[model samples]
Every structure is written in C-alpha cells, then in structure tokens.
Target: MPATTIHFVRHGQVYNPEHVLYERLPGFHLSERGVRMAQATAQFVAENPATQSLAAIYSSPLDRTKETADIVCQAVNQARRVRQEKPLSVQFDQRLIEAGNNFRGKRIGRGDGALWRDGNWRLLTNLMKPSWGESYRSIASRMTDFTYEQVARYPGQQILVVSHESPIWTLRHLLETGRPEHNMFLRHAALASITSITFDSSTQKVLGITYADPAGGVQ
Candidate 1:
C-alpha cells in the first residue's frame, strides 16, 4: 500500500472485435478497431500532459495488455520529449488476469449458448463465482493487494498498470464511489479505459477513486 496514484488501464479490445466474450482464450491480439482505440489512447495520454510523467509501467502478461502498454509508453515518451533508450520497461503482473469465464474454450457470439443479450442472465449470475469460474471476492482481493503493493514501491507517484477487464473492474468495485456490488456484471471498464485509485500505504484503506476514463471518450 502506498500514497500513490494507481492508474489501471484495461487492455485494448481483442481480436474478437465483434464484441463477443473473449476470456481465457490466450494469444488474442488487438483487432483493427482495437489498434485504433489504442492509438486514440496514446494520443489522449500524450496530449493530456498530466499522464506524461509516469515512472514505471506494469501490465498483465496477456498480449492485449502488453500491446496497450507499449503504445502508451511511446505516447508518453514522445510527449515528454524523451531522448533516452528504453524509456519504460513494462513488467507483467499475473494477478491482473480477467475474471475467470466458464466460456473460455467456446467462440462467444449471438448464436453461442453463452452469449446473452443481458449480461445478467440467470446463466451468468454471480459471475464472480461462476459455476464455471472463479469468485469475485478472490479476484477483487488479489488485484487490490497487488495494486497497493506496487504503488508502495513508488510513493507519491503515478504508475501505469495495464490489466484485464474483470480484474480492473473488481479493483474499481472495491475503490469506486458507486454501489459496491455493481461490478459483478454492469461494470464496464472499456478498451483502453483508465481507473485511478489511491490508498494509505500503512493502513491499506482506499483513500478514494480519483479519476476514471479521464480520456476515453464515447465508445
């Protein structure tokens, strides 16, 4: 835990640009829309100025997160007029995996048995503890701890953390100002969306969620 600004950015959209549920399926790359989204993320962070001062970048081992981190690093680097090699070394933190999905091996779509018009369908109830997957409590606790620990390593600072949707949303559920359990289904940390949090290093109590999706415009 540290008195630092933790910027948690969700990974870019997956190759499943069709908006299907993509989980546990490893090696999915950024789709064309995802690439453009990532670039928009880069430009937003680059032009924002406040985000150009990150000291370290950490990400999930997932390809989507890694790709997003790379582009963000370049944008921030270019913004700061940096002239050094390896401006930022991105580190992978596994605690950032997406909320375990039961539909991992299947192609999720309208025709798929798992795909649902309403995310809260009875089949998907208690998504955290999906009969097919992991618990919300587990994901939330681990991710919050990981984020707090990392923030401590760099106090009073800003760090970029590229992670998956569920993990990021879980963290948000724990730190955000809204209803506590809204994250189980409706929490949408879109592609390249950012959620910021701060907590006391000693007590580990979340001070608050400072800013979220500060630059993610429509869609």
Candidate 2:
C-alpha cells in the first residue's frame, strides 16, 4: 500500500512578555528567537530530500503559527522554484487551532492573579482529561479528522502542518496509547519540532512515527 506522511509542527515561541496564558488569543506573534527557530526548521525541510517536495502546507490561523508557517513556506517555495516545482501556500485550518483553555489571559502558578487563585482552582479536578479546558479527546478528534482528510487527499505524498502544542501532542498520544488523556506537563512536542507520522494510504493505519527537532538547538 502507498504511504502518506504528515509532518505536524508545533509553532515557535511566542512574544508574550506578560507570560499570561495566550491560549487562542490575538496579537501573539513569534519572538525574534522564534523566527530563528522557524527558519532553522524551514531550512531543514527545504534541504531534506524526504520533505523538500511536500504536497501541501496547513497551519492554524493564529499569529504565531501563521508566522512560523510563513517562514517555512518562503523557504520551501524558494527551494521549489529552483527545481521548477509549483510553490505551495499555507492553508489555514480551524481544526489545527490551539486547544481551547479556561485560563486565557491569566497567569498560572503562584503570585497575584494566578489561574489557581479565586474559584479557578476547582477546574484542576482532572489532569489526564484536562478539566481545565478542552478535553484531550476533543483535541485528538479534531486533529485526527484533519489528518485523515489530508491523508486521503495526498496519498503516497507528504504534507506540512503548523499548529500549537496541545493539538499536535494530543493526537500523537491518542495514536500511540489508544487514548487521548495524558499528563499535560509531560508533552514532548517541543517548540518548532516536527512529529512525522506515516499512514497506510488505503487503511489509514499508522505505519510509523518519527520526530525531529531541527530547531531544537536554536534556543
């Protein structure tokens, strides 16, 4: 069977000086180092034979993710131009958006106006299922839906996805463990990392999963 691979990338660091939970918030673009991180990943993808000819690019419609996607797209398209291949644009997908959170605009862990302060501490009832905001199942569901569609659309090919940490890791957790619930603090999807999952085109079964941290050394 032909195989299809999806490269899911978590966006780079955001320019959040306030350190508030910028979950699904506006005006959170990439920091300078974040741009460098994205550029590193972009160069890796453009030069890597396995991913240089990506079929499509999808991104969450958020400032940080879009910025990262834009940088990668530029590099990939420039490389494609050298080979006379048609350039691809970043396609925004709502399913790839950041997981919803109840702590938007609030800082967590200690100090004044923390998320745990006031009555918000009640939301910490469950960590596995993440009672604080959107459930892991929901995040995995949306990401899986998008993945399956792309798998069918670009059978035997590869694609790039720029999204937030929770959605990317949640889907991987579900695929690997047969469950979406996990410890939030133990996620492995680092900033600007790529989690590539290959699927059997006809069966949609995961054939293999690999991870690369091209921008890991940027920080």
Candidate 3:
C-alpha cells in the first residue's frame, strides 16, 4: 500500500461587478483575470513534480468550476501521463458545490444594500451556526466523505478536486483541526488556491495537510 494525496482547488474569480453573493447561482463564469488565474494554476500544478502523479480530476458542476477543471485536465494531460493511456477526465461531484446561501443575488455588504436593510433580521441573528446558509458541519461532513471515498478508490495515486471557496475552506478546517466552526471573515483560501490532503493508503487515515496559492502575485 502507498500513500495518496488529494488537492482541493477553489475556482477563480467571477465577473461580478455588483459583487453579488452568487451562491449556487447559474451562469456566473470566470472573469478575464480569472481565466488567466485558472491557467496559471493549471500550469503551476502541471510543472510541479509533486503533483505529476495525479490520477483523476473532479470538480463541481458549476460553470466556473467546470471551466477551471477543463483547463487543469488539459494541462495535466499534456504535462504528465497517468497510469491510464487516456488523459484524466474531469468528473462532476455535487458534494463539491458551493455552500447554500440565502443571500444569493443580493449585494452583501455593511452598507444599505446589505441584508439587514430589508428587515431580514432572522438571517443575521446567529453567526456562530451561520443562519444565512448551509451549516459548516454539513459542508464538512459531505466533503470529508467525498475525500475519504476518493482516497479509498485511488490509493497510491493523487486526485484533484475543483470546488468552491466555502466547501474547500470548511473541509480544510475540519480535516486540519477537527473543528467545523468557520469564520467567513477569516478565510485563507484564496481564489484558485490548492489545499492538499495526504492519506495513508493502507489505513485510509489522514496523514497531513498543506496549502498553496499557485496563482499568487500573478494578477
């Protein structure tokens, strides 16, 4: 038995001039800068020796994630050869979708456009459990289950999962410290960032975790 690694990648920035929450919203594709960012991330992963052994790629079904996954799969196919003769294909996983939010299509801010102005006090009453959207525990549970499943299915290999910011960060926090409480303001998961998890192939136990911003400083 050999060790396995999984990389959780957050999608690039979207072309939202209004800065809408866009939670699970459709048709929100990547911006121009985002395209460059995704390409840079794919190239970074392709050139990195550690990720050369990636065997499979998985992504959320959202347009942004699908676009990023396509670019990454192409780069990995051209740069590295997996055990299979064909290039690694991108698979869709609903569990990797963005966290549900009631604030979708709304401009989120402390100004007048905020949710509070509309008298939606119920949504803001509980920040600990996050009354606005899906609970952190739910995201963590789903992501953890998906990760362990992939590890078990692909022992001795590496896999890449392209996902949204909330799910990626929540899963990272849970796997890293065994806590699911997440603070949106304290997020470290940059757009197009990669969070790596290492697992013991024999026991399917989590060994360690790491983080990287492949598109950093590439604005």
Candidate 4:
C-alpha cells in the first residue's frame, strides 16, 4: 500500500472587527496582518518537501481562502523558480466551507454571542451544545468525510486544503486521535495555521502530526 499526505490550512484573519459574526459572508477579505501570515505560510510550503509531492490544492470557496490559495500558489511556482511543471492551481469547493452557522451575517463584536457573553466568539466546548451555531459533531462529520473521500480518490497524492478555523480544527481532531476529547479540548487550530496529516495506504495507519503557524503559531 502507498500513503496519502494532506496539507490543511486555516484561512487568514478577515478584515472585520466590529462585527458579531461572519458565518459565510462573501466580502470578508483578509486583514493586513493576515496577508503577511499567508505569505509566510506560502513560503514554508514552497521550500518544504511536500511541495514536490503536492498533487492538488483545494480551498473553501470563501474569498479569504481563495486569496490565500492564490498567494501560496505563487510561492509554489517552481515553473518559474526551478523550471518544474506548471504552478499550482487551487480547486475551490463549497464543501470545504465552514459549517453553517446562525451567525451568517451578524456582527461578531457587538454585545455578546450566545455562548460568549463577553463579545468574543465562544469556545468549541461551550458552543457544542448550543443552538447558537452548528454543532461540533456536524462540522466534524463533514470535514472528515470529505477528507477521507479525497484521500481515497487521490490515492498516493499529496494535497493542500485552505479553509476556515472551525472546520480545520474539526478535521485535525478527527485525524489526530479520533477521540471525543480531541474535539472538545485538544484541538485549537488558529488562523493561517498549517496542520499536516499522513495516511498510509499500506498499513492504513494515520501517521504523524506536523503543525505550524508563523503568526503566533498556536497561541
């Protein structure tokens, strides 16, 4: 059996601060710092061994992720840098979008979110049982399902996925231990963060975890 490698990245920060939430807003583009973060992340991928193995790149259809993917593609342009095949072209997919939330258009920093009475967004555990947003299980299911399906189809390919915070964290939880606690506590993936998971088609064991975030890593 062979192995499948995936490079999953969370989207950079959006330019909204006064908003209560931004569930699926179309115009929520990246902030200035976010641009730098994405640029650094792209550089990391560019110089890493994974770049040579990357068979495809997929991203959430949101503007932030789309833009991040574009910048990263530039870094992976070995066609210009090392005279390899054409540069990477990210394939946008709606299924990679964050799990649906009631915060569709609500401002995030107004008064208080249902779970976060202090204005900030709620933690995953606190938000887990509330109807204020989508359930953790629902998000976990979607991300993992799509990931597994992608791996099965691509076989030994290395892939990259650009998506949002929650969805990316949920996928990491599923990949790491597949335990309930990882979802509830251990998974705290950040904006513009990169998390890698490898699956051996040979032994069927999901091996290793290599995570990094140039902008404040995991804080």
Please report the candidate that would top TM-score against the real structure. 2
| lDDT of residue 115 for candidate 2 | 84
Model 4: lDDT equals 0.73
Write model 2 residue lDDT over 52-92, tens digit each, in one string: 88999999999999999999999999999999999999999
Model 3 TM-score (2 dp): 0.92
Candidate 2 vs candidate 3, lDDT winner: 2
- Taking all chains together, each candidate's TM-score versus the true structure is 0.80, 0.97, 0.92, 0.82
Superposition TM-score, candidate 4 onto the true structure: 0.82
**Candidate 2 has which clashing residue pairs, if any?**
none
- Residue 177, candidate 2: Cα error in Å is 1.2
State how far residue 45 of model 3 sits from its true place (Å): 0.8
In model 4, the runs with Cα more than 4 Å from the true position are 78-81, 109-126, 179-186, 202-204, 217-219
For candidate 2, the TM-score is: 0.97
Which residue segments of model 3 deviate by more than 4 Å? 81-85, 109-114
Give per-residue CA lDDT, model 4, range 51-144, as digits (tens).
5457788999988899888888777775335855666688987778976775566553434453355443544335444345676677777777
User: Which candidate model has the greater TM-score, 1 or 2?
Assistant: 2
User: Mind giving the per-residue lDDT tens digits that candidate 3 earns over 36-151?
Assistant: 88999999898898886688999999999999999899999987554455677899999999999888877766776765668766678676578988999999999888988998
lDDT of 4 at 131: 47
Give the least accurate 10-residue stretch of model 4, judged by summed lDDT. Answer: 177-186
Give each model's whole-structure lDDT: 0.71, 0.93, 0.87, 0.73
By lDDT, highest first, what's the ranking?
Answer: 2, 3, 4, 1
Name the better of 1 and 3 by lDDT: 3
